[model samples]
Target: MRTIAEIKESIEADFMRNETAAKLYGFTSGDSFAAFFGKLSVESVLFYLFAVAAWTLENMFESFRSEVNASIDKMKPHRPKWYRDMVLAYMKDRTLIPDTDEYDTADMTDEEITAARVVKHAVADESDDASLLTIKVAGEQGGRRCPLDAQTESQLKAYIAEIKDAGVRTALVNIAPDRFNCELDIYFDPMLLASAVESTCREAIQNYIENLPFNGEYTNMALVDQLQKIDGVRIPELRSATTVAAGESVVTAIDARCVPAAGYFEMGDVKLNMKVYNG
Candidate 1:
């Protein structure tokens, strides 16, 4: 991290050392000295020297930085939690939707890939021969939280297969959809006219609950706070916030937190059943 002035000073000092060496060898011509050492003071020549020295220093610093980073990374734990999260992040953008070509992603816009998410689960079991590792991946996309089609799922499975350890007797890749429907009962003020309610309230609430940070537990307090902020809504209460599979039975009076069994949270419709009351 030497400053420009420091590096320039060092380069100038080097030029002076070479000038002194020339004088010691009887090569000094007071009139021609300007032709030799004067070149070091010339703006263009000085700039060139500074540039080369700075570039060499920068390259050396980069190599040292990379080595230090590598050592730090190696010293860090390689436990499953860290590895799983790393795999999940690596697969997010690397994954593809059904029937989409690999090159198509480069041409595709950001909006097209905004909803993509990757969830991973590792299971170890002993079989007849040796221990086996089974990695399950769930890829979700779009508003409805649909799963990747067969083709894309296969491609994603192949993409992650390279991370398997050699000691594993067998490594299997499991892929599926992670769509979860969230049912909620939100109470509102009766004085507020129904017509005044925003048509996008359902969408808003859906986005709020859905967009809760990945691997985060959904809290009823957060959801209620967001719902209460809506127009024509007051004293919002989540009577029920049950997480269920798509088309599955919605358990009433269950835990308000939508805790994911796996890492991904494929949010479904808000299913807000609004009740109006004076309280």
Candidate 2:
């Protein structure tokens, strides 16, 4: 199997890494953080700074891809309107470009096809569950402890029901990770550490749910006082990440999954808010 670094490189190369695309999906902005950042109130000056940073980086990448596509079409000889049309097409498809000399791929043969199929099955162990909520509450005391409460369970059930309208199934998978760090003094600095921890746990819990086998892999989770908020913690990962299907070829419906999630909760004079999603 390829090493983690190799897997990361393979993904990068698959996208035809230009510096712009690299920055657009930079390492610092992990998938989880990118999702949370987007839902922030950009109207606030503090949050607006992030909005500018993300947007500026975004435009830079788009401009670079546009120029590359434009050049590729101009250099190749094709129908009068072909160059103009194909550039847009090429921009949308990451596999081809004016700069890719070795992009030439030969037709697949029986042996190559068989080998590909084998590789797929080798790494095919994964799962299915619709909705998962990992709620961590702040406790006046700090050990890893909290059990499902009636009010908490009902609140999350309502949240899950709302999402059911979207044709998405959600099953709450509760995990009790080591509770909040009370001594860390969340009040000292806006609960940045708590927020970060909250982000990580939410992601971990969701991932655990998605990989769980359907028969009976999960039970509802709950906690107290670590994140003292009544509504629990929230962190949204994406906004409208999926394109609605229209059943038309030219419409070119995007098939990628967009999971935008948010986690919210509060602790000692501070609140934890985070999101995770990739478009």
Candidate 3:
């Protein structure tokens, strides 16, 4: 959208280019409308009116462009990202109004529906079949990602069934966070107590794991780098790292980077072996 200043400048440029209009308006070729006409003059007043009209036109053009883009989005087929958005938008215990996908807002307030939306983080990806989509979602509980309650999970599944495109299958994944276990060797300065440093290091490690983006990658090197940032630590080494997916018994060693099967991860057994560094 053109700004009011830009519109006014364009008008002045056009007025200056027209010799006939400049002569009739008593404006010199080298002088702009603002330079030739006083603020309260008739010419200045008319020029301001033109600028306002052009500004209005620019706004209308922008509005029209936005409407066109929205229409295009509505017509496009639903993709994985769109499914993720739909999952996050699910409201618990709300029934869709007949013949429409939207809930009855008149019966329930917007704030109520918003509060009912429990899913905080979600990711959707295509399964082996192109027509099938796997969606992972979690709600925020105690400031960490967690699975929804049984009742809420049922409601969310029903909502997905109703809104999903025909011939497309959606599998919902709302489970406990994957467990991450790691052993770290920390070399700390002699000034700080090893116990205090160990406590802070554990907190730092928990924060780093819980704060990773949902469905984000976890790397051994990244954890080492995070541990090295703590004060009184000279060298931080990751001895071993392993993860067990939620509801699974098999553990997988993390060589470099591993994306959690569950959308997020929780702290498991973290062993901090602290050693005093004299050098």
Residue by residue across 89-135, what tens digits does model 1's lDDT show? 43444644554322236765766554343443332334454454344
Rank ordering of all candidates by TM-score, starting from the highest: 3, 1, 2
Clashes of 3: 0
Instruction: State model 3's lDDT.
Output: 0.86
Model 2, 21-90: lDDT tens digits are 4476563322333332343434234434544565666678889999999898656533313322222122
Candidate that scores best on lDDT = 3
Global CA lDDT computed for model 1: 0.53
Provide the lowest-lDDT 10-residue window in model 3.
Answer: 99-108
Worst window of 10 by summed lDDT in candidate 1: 117-126
Better candidate number, 1 or 2, judged by lDDT: 1
**In terms of TM-score, which candidate is strongest?**
3
Per-candidate clash tally: 0, 33, 0
Q: TM-score for all predictions?
A: 0.52, 0.17, 0.88
Please list the C-alpha lDDT of all candidates, in the order they appear: 0.53, 0.32, 0.86
Give the distance in Å from residue 31's predicted Cα in candidate 3 to where it truly belongs: 5.3
